[model samples]
Structure formats: structure tokens, C-alpha cells
Target: MRETVRWRNAVFAVFFAMGFGFASLAARFPTARDALDISVDQLGLALLGISIGSIAGLSTASHVVARLGTRAVVSVGVVVVGVGLAIAGWGVEARSMAVLVVGLVVTGLANGITDVAMNLSGAANERALAKPIMPIFHAFFSFGTVAGAGFGALGEATGLGMGPQMTIVLVAIGALSVVVRPRLVEQPIQPEDHVGFRERLSVWTDARTWLIGGLVLGMALTEGSANDWLALLMVDGHDFDPVGAALAFALFLTAMTAGRLAGVPLIERFGRVAMLRATGALAAVGLVLVIVVDDQVVALVGTALWGLGASLGFPIGMSAAADDARMATARVGAVATIGYVAFLAGPPMLGFLGEHLGLRDAMWVVLAFVLLSLATSAVAREPRTASGAPDPAAEVRP
Candidate 1:
């Protein structure tokens, strides 16, 4: 039990670090734009590098995990992420779009690999503990983002440039990676016959897997959209300054953190489907509020609601995909790959829309995805037993 606790804490640290690194980059989006002297559409096009690299990484994550184990993959991924951050910072400082795109692509690849490996570790921990803890782990991720964004905001307010800021964050994450390396859980080696590339990839043919992927896709859009563009929208659409915009983005992440922390018990009491439906409604209402209301206070409130609504979908999708433990890695890889379609497509699509309709208006696209997630929430039911029978006892709640 003590060992389990230690492992869990180690995984929490990893998630926190990942969130912190990503949010650090996110908070600097405006700076990158200004430094590079790029238009919104150009920025969006450049951001496509992340999508391209993330898709590549997601496609091959299961095989990497199978070969190298989660701990090693995560360790290597952290170093690569640091290198990517340094490169991105250099690009921003030098005002080179080509360099910036390369940096983003590299960062995205490392991030994608780290994402699957850490979630797999979290799922394994959940099985060992016999409880619903995935949301709590994700809450720590939100906490990390909050810290990173807040730090970036402070730096921005104080006149710190993007280059120095990212360098400091990268160094911190690299050190943390070393500290947490020893505590990660190690999976037993599987025989080659147990999980071939073909068999591992077979989850793609499962209808239920695609439904879960669809649900995750919507949630990913909801969350990824906010991560990539919320602050910029506030600045461009609402006439807010950069610091204020950063604070607003931080508020969204804080609300998300609170929602995830509060969701653990709610999920225990209500089951996954009911809670998802309620949150989906909250997200839709939130986005509507942001679109129609001009008042900053009202918009921020809507942002909070949107954050709460989106908090559960991605993490819950991961938990659902891992329900059949024997096939966890493969299923997780499939779900993550499908879900990332939103990340891959969101930036350029929204940028194009923002070019004509405005950023605020383009966000209405989020509503369509939210509704789709609500429609498919029922597919997230518990996994079946070995006899292929539904196991009520194995459901997320009682």
C-alpha cells in the first residue's frame, strides 16, 4: 500500500510537469505572434506543426510503450520536450517562423508520447487501488497548468521575455523528471504472441472504441480550443490587455481544476453517464454565454462553466478505454489518436473562421462537438467480465 501511494505520487508529479510545460508555452502565444509578426491565420498555420507531430507520436505510442516501458518513455519524452521548448524560445527570440514551427512540432511529438505513457501509468494505478482516482490525478494536471499560466502571467506583467521564461520552465521540468523517475510502476513484459502490432491495432474495428473516441474528440476540442486560443480571443474579441487575458485563461484552468477535484465523489454517486450529461449542458451554456455576452465578468463566468463542463471528458475517456486491462495500451492509443483529431484540426479551422467571422464567433463550433459528446455518453459504460457479461459492480460508480 505504501509503495502504491509512492507510485501514485510519482505519476501525479509527472502529470503536473506535463501540464506546466504546455501551459507555459500557451501563455506565450501572444508574445510568439508579436515577435514573429504573424497574422492570426499565419499563427494558426504554424501551430499545425504541433498537430502533425502529435499525430505521428500518437500513432506509434503503443509500440514504444511495449518496447521501452512507461518510465523510460516518460523520462526520454521529458528531455525531448525541454529541447523543444528551448528551440521554440530561440525561434521566438530570433523572429523566425520556420524555427518556431520546427520547435512546436518537436514539442508536440514529445508531449504526445508523454501523454499516453502517463495516462497508462495512471490507469494501472487506478486498477491497483480499486477506486476512482483518474479525475483527481487530472486535477493535479490542472493545478500544474494554473501554476504555469500564473507564472507566465506574472512574468509578462513584469516584462520577462518568452526566451528566458521558457528556459527556466524547461530546466525545472527536467529536474523533476529525474526525481520522479524511480517511482513509476513497471509492467511485466508481454510475450510477442500476446500483443502483436496487428492485434494491438485491432481496437480500431470496435464500434464502442470509436464512440468513446468521438466523445473524447469533442472534449479535446473543448479543452484544446481553450488552451490554444482563449487568451487571444479575450484580447482580440473583448478588447482586454495581455495581462488581463492571461488572468482570464488562468481562471478557466482554475475552474477546471476545481471541477475535477469536486468530480471524484460526484462520479462515485451519479455514475459516468449522468454526470457527463450534466457537465455537457454546463459547457454548452458556458460557451453560449461567452458568445452573446460582452461584459468581461459575464464572459469569465461563462469560461468557468465551460471549464467545469469540459473537465471530465478526456480523463473519463481514458479510464473507459482502459476498462479491459489486458488491452489497455492499445485501446488508449486508439482513443488518444482519434481524440487528437480535434487538436490537429482546431487551430487552422478556428483561425480560418476567426479571419472572417471573428474569434469569438468561431467558438460556436465548440457547441456542435459538445452536443455530440452528450449524445454518445452512454457508450462509456463499464467493461464486461471475462465471460463477456456486463459487470454492474465494475462500473465507474456503484
Candidate 2:
């Protein structure tokens, strides 16, 4: 138990750093916009480069993690994120939009690498520990979001150009990540499954895998939506100040952490499917509350519902992806990659919907997908484990 706790602690720290760095970009949005002198549409386009890079990088993640092992991969990922942040910060200081875009692309790639590697490593750790651990790892990300908001305010107070401010933040987090890595159980990754392209294609073609994968896709979309637009909606729709708007996100993530801690036991009592169904309703209810309420307190409660509903998705989905006895790790990787692509696509698509139909209406679209995921989860098949999990039917949520 002690070793297990230490390993998870390391994973948690890395997650915290990644989440903090990523969330800080939310703070920099206005600065990026003003520095480039661009309209909202142009700003969206420029930012789309990051999403594009994430999509491209996710395609190769299994290969990278398989070859490098999670330890080295995670280490490199942290460094990459730090360097990309620095570059973006430098671009902002230089007042070069082109350079900023390039920097964002690099940042996106780094984000993609870390995202997949950490999820895989977290899953591996959960398996080794014989417990549900992924939620705790993600809980740290929530902590980071709260911390990042503060970090950003400090950066702004210093009156440094975004480049210097963000670089300092990223560098500090990256150093912590290095210190954290050695404490974890870093194992040598085996060579990826040798199934050829034609075999891999067959796994993708399966109806059940797609059903499970679709659940992953929807959840990813919902989380990404919260990440990209929760602050904007509070500010634009509710007329919140910057700090107030950020607090909405902080509320949402705090609820997410609390929910995950609660979820461990619930997932133990029920399978991934039952918990997913519950979260879907919870999220939809939250969205409705946010849309209909006038009181700030009520609105914040709605965000908390949204967070609780979203907390367990990736862990559950990854388990489902590996459920097929016949599927290879490569195929599992493919499904996970597809889900992230959905994540990349979701936010901007939501932005477009928000722009055209109002943010509330766009938020409704997310609820629609959440409902679909709930229905799908009811029948989602379990992954066929190579080593029989301590108890597959036990409360393993992820």
C-alpha cells in the first residue's frame, strides 16, 4: 500500500503540472488576442492550430509510449510542455502572431503526448495496485486548475509580457514533474502487439468497440467543452468579472475532485455502466441549472454537477476499449486516440454553435451527447483482461 501510494502520488504530481500549465492558457487568452490584434473568429482560427497538433500527435501516442515506456515518455512530455510554453511566451513577448501559433502547435503536441501517456500509465498503476486509482490522479488536475488560476493572477500582477510570465510558470511546474517521476513504479514497456494494419482495421470496424468508443468520445467532448468555454459563458452570459468567471471553473473542478473521490466506492458497487448513466443525468441537470438560474450560487452548483458527471469518463472508457479478448494493444490505442480526436473537435464545434445559437443552446448540445453516452454505457462490454483483475465485476470504474 505504501509503494502504491507513492506511485500514485508521482502520477498525481505530473497531472497537476500538466493541468496547471494547460489551464493557465485560459488566463492568457485575452493577452494573446490583444497582442495579435485579432477578432474572435481569427483568434479561434489561430488557437485551432493547437487542437490540430493535438490530433496529429495523439495518432502516434501508442507507438511512442510503447517504445519509450511510460516513465521516459512522461518525463519527455513534461519537458516538451515546458519548452512549448516557453516558446509561446517568447512569441508573445516578440509580438509575433506567427511565432505564437507555432508555439501553440508545439504546446498542443506536448499536451497530446502527456495526455495519452499519463492515462496509460495511470491505468497501468491502477492494475498493479489492484484498486481504482485513475480518479485520484485526475483529482490532482482539479487541484492544478484552482492553483493555475492563482498562478495566472500572480503572473498578471507582475506586469510581464505573457512570454516571461507563462515561461516562469511552466518552468516551475516542469521542475516539480522531474522531482515527482522517480518515485513512481516505472516499468519497461513491452513491444507493441504485432498485429498488422488489416487486423487493426477489423477491431475498428466492430459495432461494440465503436459503442464503447463513442462513450469515450462524448465524455471527452463534454470535458473539453468545460475546459474551453465555462469561463466564457459565465462572463458573457452572467456578466461576471474575470475572477468571478474563473471561479466558475474552479467550482466545477472542485466538484469534479469531490465526485471522483466519491465515485471510487460507487463504481465498486456498480459497474462502469451504472456510474456513467448517473453522471449523464447529473451533467444534464447541471447544465439546465446553469442555463435557467439567475442566482450566482445556483449557477455555481450547476457547474459542480457538470464536473461530477464528467469525472470518471476516460478511466471507464479505456477499460472498455481493452474489453475485447481478440483486440491488440495497438487497437486499444487506436480507440483511445479516436476519442481524443473527438475531444479536439468538440470545443471548436461548440464554439461555433455558441456563436450561432447562443452559448446556452450550445451547452444543450453537450447534454444531448451525454444522454447518448448514458444509453450506450448500459450495454458497453467489459474489456478482456490479460491478467484477471482482482475482481473485474468489483467496483473498478476505470
Candidate 3:
């Protein structure tokens, strides 16, 4: 149990670092745009670099983890993230859009690799702990985003540019990664678990896998759209200043953190399907409020609801994909790949829509996806046991 606790803590640290690194970039999006002197549409196209790199990373993460193990992949992912941040910072300082795109691509790849590796670690730990702790792990990620956005806001208030701000964050994340790497469990893929390359590619044939991936795609869009656009939306759509926009973004992250922390018990009581349905409705309403309502206070409330609604989808999808431990890595990779398509396609699509229809109107695209998730929530039901009975032991509890 003590070792389990240690491994859990280690995995939490990795998730936190990943969140911090990503949020550090996210929080600085406005500054990055200004430095490059680009329009919203152009920024969206450039941000596609992240999606491209992430797709590449997700495509190969399962195979890499199978060979190099989770710890090593996570460690390498940290270094890659740090380097990517530095290059991104340099791009901003140099006022080079090309450099910035390259940096974002690198950061996205690292984010993808670490995302799969650490979630695998988290899922293994969840099985060992025999509790519904994936939400808590995701909560730490929200906490990290909260911290990163808070610091970014502070840096912006103090007139610090992206370069200095990211440098400080990169150093801190690098140090934390070093501290936690050794403590991660060395759970390499077993010999029997290994399969031929053709067999490994066969996860796509599973309908359940694609259903889960579809759910995650909706969640990822809901979450990623907010992460990439909320601040900009406030500024462009609502006529807020930079500081106010950052505050709104911070509020979103805080609300998400709260929801995830509160989610474990709710999930324990309601089960994954019911909880997801409830939250999905809340998120849809929140999006309506943000888009249709004219008042800032009401819109901010909508943002909070949106955050709370989106908090569980990605984590729950990950948990569902890993329900069968034997095929966890492959399923996770496929689902992540399918889900991240939202991330890849969302920015450019929204950017073009925002350019034509206005940013607030562009967000209406998310509503369709959220409804899709609600319809598919049943796919996340707990796995059945050998006798074809729903496995009570597999139901996660707080």
C-alpha cells in the first residue's frame, strides 16, 4: 500500500508537470499572437502544428512505451516539453512565426507522448489501488493549470514577456521531473503482451474503442477549445482587456479543478454514465450562456459551468479505455489519437469560423459535439466479468 501510494504520488507529479507546461503556453497565447503580429485565423493555422506533432506522437506512443517503459518515456517527454518551451519563448522574442510553429509542434509531440505514458501509469495505479482515483489525478492537472494561468497573469501584469515567463516555468518543471522520475514504477510491457505489428494495428476494428474515442473527441474539443480560445474570445467577443481575459481563463481552470476534485464522489455514487450525462447537459447550457448572453457576469458563470461540465469527460474516457488491462495501452493510444483529432481540427476550424461568423458564434460548433457525447455515455459503462455479469469489483469508489 505504501508503495502504491508512492507510485500514485509520482504519477500525480508527472500529470501536474504536463498540465503546467501546456498551460504555460496556453496562458501566453495572446502574447504569442501579438509578438508574431498575426490575425486570429493565422494563429489558428499555426496552432495546427501542435495537432500535427501530437498526432505523430500519439500514433507511436503505445509502441514506444512497450519498448522503453513508462518511466523512460515520461522522462524524455519532460525534457522535450522543456526544450519546446524554450524554443517557443525564443520564437516570441525573435518575433518569428516560423520558429513559433516549430516550437509548438515539438511541444505538442511531447505533450502527446507524456499524455499516453502517464495515463497508462495512472490506470495501472488505479487498478492496484482499487479505487476511482483517475478523477483525482486529472484534478491535479487542473490545479497545475490554475497555478500556471495565475502565474502567467501575474507575469503579464508585471510586464514580463513570454520568454522570461516560460523560462522560469521550464526550469521549475525540469526540476520536478528529475525528482519524480526515479520513483515511477518500472512496469515494462510483458513478453506475452507483445504482439506482431499487424495485430497491434487491429484495435481500430473495435466499435467500442471508436465509441469511447468519439466521446473523448467531444470532450477534448470542449476542453481544448476553451483552453485555446476562451481568453481570446473574451478579448475579441466581449471587449475585455488582457488582464480581465486572463482572470476569466483562470476562473475557468479553477472551476474545472473544483469539479474534478468533487467528481470522484459523484462518480462513485452515480456511476460514469449517469455522471457524464448530467455534466454533459450542464456544459451544453454553459456554452449557450457564454455565446448568447450579453452580460459579462453571466458569461463568466457560463464559463464556470462549462469547465465543470468538461472536467470529467476526458478522464472518464481514459478510464473506460483502460478497463481491460490486457489491451489498455493500445486502446488508450487509439482513443487518444481519435480524440486529439478534435484538438488538431478545432483551432483552425474555429479560427476560420471566427474570422467569418465572429468568435462567439464560432463556439456554437461545440454544442453538436457535446450532444454527441451525451448520446454515447452508455459506452463508458463498467466492463463485465467472466460470467457476463457486471463486475461490481470493477466499479470504482472513492
Candidate 4:
């Protein structure tokens, strides 16, 4: 019991650290673009490095985790993330596009691997606790992003250069990882249980796996769109100043974080399918409010609703993916890959559509995806057992 408690706390810390480091880098995007003297389109292309790297990393994460175990993969991955951060800082200071692209790729690769390993660990801990704890683990991630963004804001206010600021932050993150390393619980894969690449890909053939991936994709895109464009939406659609737009975005983040923190009890009571459908509907309503309403206040309310609605989907989807302990790694990795492709690719796709339809109209695309998530929510229900009851042991195994 004590060990479970420790592992849970450690997972929280890992999620938090990952969130902080990623946000710290993200907050510098505008600064990096300006430093490099790149056009917005150019910057988007540059950001594709992260997408490419993440795809590569996620594609092989199961194999890597099988060999190294979650603890080693995540620990080493965090340290690598720090190294990537330093390189990105240098790229920004030097204004070298090639270097910056390489750095982003490295960071994305590390983040991708770390993301799978940590979530697998979190799912394992959830089994040990026999409760719905994944949402709170993700809530800590949100907390970390808020803190990291604040750190970046402080640097901006103080006129700190990007290189020095990232260097300082990454070093701290790396040191924290060392402290976090031993706390992560190990999941041993027996030699016989380990499979080759072809066997691992079998999860890809499962209909339920694809359905769960669809649910995750929609919810993830809903969240990712706001992350990438919410402030801009406020500014462009509502005529808000930069500060006000930022505050609005902050509200969205706060609502999302609060939602995650509050989700587990709700999920436990209502069950996964019902909660997913409910949240998907909420997100759709929020999108409609923003897309159709002209008033700024209405848009702000919609943004909050959107955040709240989008909050639980990712974690719940992850929990669903890891439903079967024996296939946890492959299923989790596959589902995550689908969701992340949405996250990384959705924003730019919206940017493309936004050019023709305007940002507000472009949100119709998101609405469609949210409805798809709603439609697919049923698949997230725990698989049935021999007696046709929910598999109690499945939840307990990972």
C-alpha cells in the first residue's frame, strides 16, 4: 500500500515535470520565430520537426519500453528532453533554423517516448489503487504547464534571453528527474511475453482500439486547438487586447485543470462511457457558443466550457486503452499515437482552414470531431469478462 502511494506521487511528479518543460519551450515560440526572422508559414513548417520526431518516437515506444522498462525509458527520456531544451535555446540565440528544427525534433522525440512510458506507469498505479486516479495525474500536468508558463512570462518581463532562460529551466528539470527516477515503479516484462515488432502491431487490428483512438483524437484535437489558437481567437474574433486575450486563455487553462482535478470521482460514479458522452456534448455546446455568438463575454464563457469539456477525454481514453494488462503497452502506444497525431497536426490544419473560412468558421471542423468523439465514446467502456461483468481484474492489472 505504501509503495502504491509512493508510485502514485512519483507519477504525479513525472507528469508535472513533463508539462513544465514542454510549456517552457512552447511559451518561447513567438520569440523564436521573431529571432529567426521567419514568416508564420515558415515557422509552421519548422514546427513540423516536432511532429516528425514524435511520430518516430511513438512508433517505437513499445519496443523501447519492453527493453528498458518504463522507469528507465522515462528517466532517460526526461534527461534527453533537457538536452533538447538547451539545444533549442542555442538555436534561438543563434537564429539558426536548421539547429532549431533539430532541437525541436529531439525534444518531440523525447516527449513522445516519455509520454507513453509515464502514462503506462500511471495506468499501472491506477490498477494498484483500484480507483479512477488518471485524471488527477493529468491535473498535475496542467499545474506544471501553468507554472512553466509563469516562469516563461517572468523571463519575458525581465528581458531574459531565450537561451539563458531555457538553459536555467532545463537544468532544473533534469536535476528533478534524477530525484524522480527511483520513485517510478517497475513493470517487468517476462522474456516470453516480449514480442517482436510484427506481433506488437496486432493491436492495430482491433476495432475497439481504433474506436478508442477515434475518441482520443477528437478530444485531443479539441484541447490542442485551444492551446494553439485560443488567444488568437479572442483577439481576432472578440477584439480583445493582448493582455485580455492572454487572460482568456488562462481562464481556459484554469477551467481545464479544475475539470481534471474533479473528474475521477465523477468518472467513478458515472462510469467512462456516460462521462465521455457528457463531456463531448459539453465541448460541442462550448464550440457552438464560440462559433455562433458574437459577444465577447459569451465567447469567454464558451472557452471555459470548452476547456472543462475537453479535460477528461485524454486521460479517460488512456485508461481505456490500457484496459487489458497483457496488451497495455501496444494498445496504449497505438491509441496515443493516434491522439498525438491529432494534437500535433490539428492546429496547422485549422490554420489552413482558418485562412479560407476565418477562425470562427474553422471551428466547425472541431465540432465535427467532437461529435465523432461523442459517437465513439461507447468504445471506452471497460471490456466485459467471462461472466459478462466488467473485468474487475483488468482494471487492477493495468
Please tell me which predicted candidate would have the highest TM-score against the true structure: 3
Clashes of each: 0, 4, 0, 0
Give the per-residue lDDT of model 2 (tens digit) for 298-377. 88889999988888776677666654423534445676767776556765677677667766677887888787778778
Show model 3 residue runs off by greater than 4 Å.
Answer: 188-192, 386-389, 396-398
Candidate 4 C-alpha error for residue 51, in Å: 1.5
TM-score for each prediction? 0.96, 0.87, 0.96, 0.91
lDDT of 1 at 287: 93
RMSD of 4: 2.4
Residue-level lDDT for 114 in candidate 1: 79
Model 4 C-alpha lDDT per residue in residues 128-188, reported as the tens digit of each score? 7887688999998888776766666566557688788878878888888888888888863
Candidate 4 least-lDDT 10 residues: 187-196
Question: Per-residue alpha-carbon lDDT of model 3 for 1-398, expressed as tens digits?
Answer: 89889889988888888777778778778888887889999989988988898998999988888878899998779878878877887788999988888988998899888889988888878777888899999999998888888887887789887887778878988898888888888753223566656666788899999999999999999999999999899988888788888889888888888989998899878888998998899899999999999889998999999999999999999988877666778888999999999989999999999888988999999988999899889999887789986675565421
Off by over 4 Å in 1: 188-193, 384-398
Distance from true location, Cα of 66 in model 1, Å: 0.4
lDDT against true structure, model 4: 0.80
Q: Which ten residues in a row have the lowest lDDT in candidate 3?
A: 187-196
Model 4: residues with Cα > 4 Å off, grouped in runs:
34-39, 188-192, 386-388, 396-398
Ranking under lDDT, best-scoring first?
3, 1, 4, 2
lDDT of 3: 0.86
Write candidate 1's Cα lDDT for 240-280 as tens digits.
79989899999999989998998879887876788889889
Candidate 1 least-lDDT 10 residues: 389-398
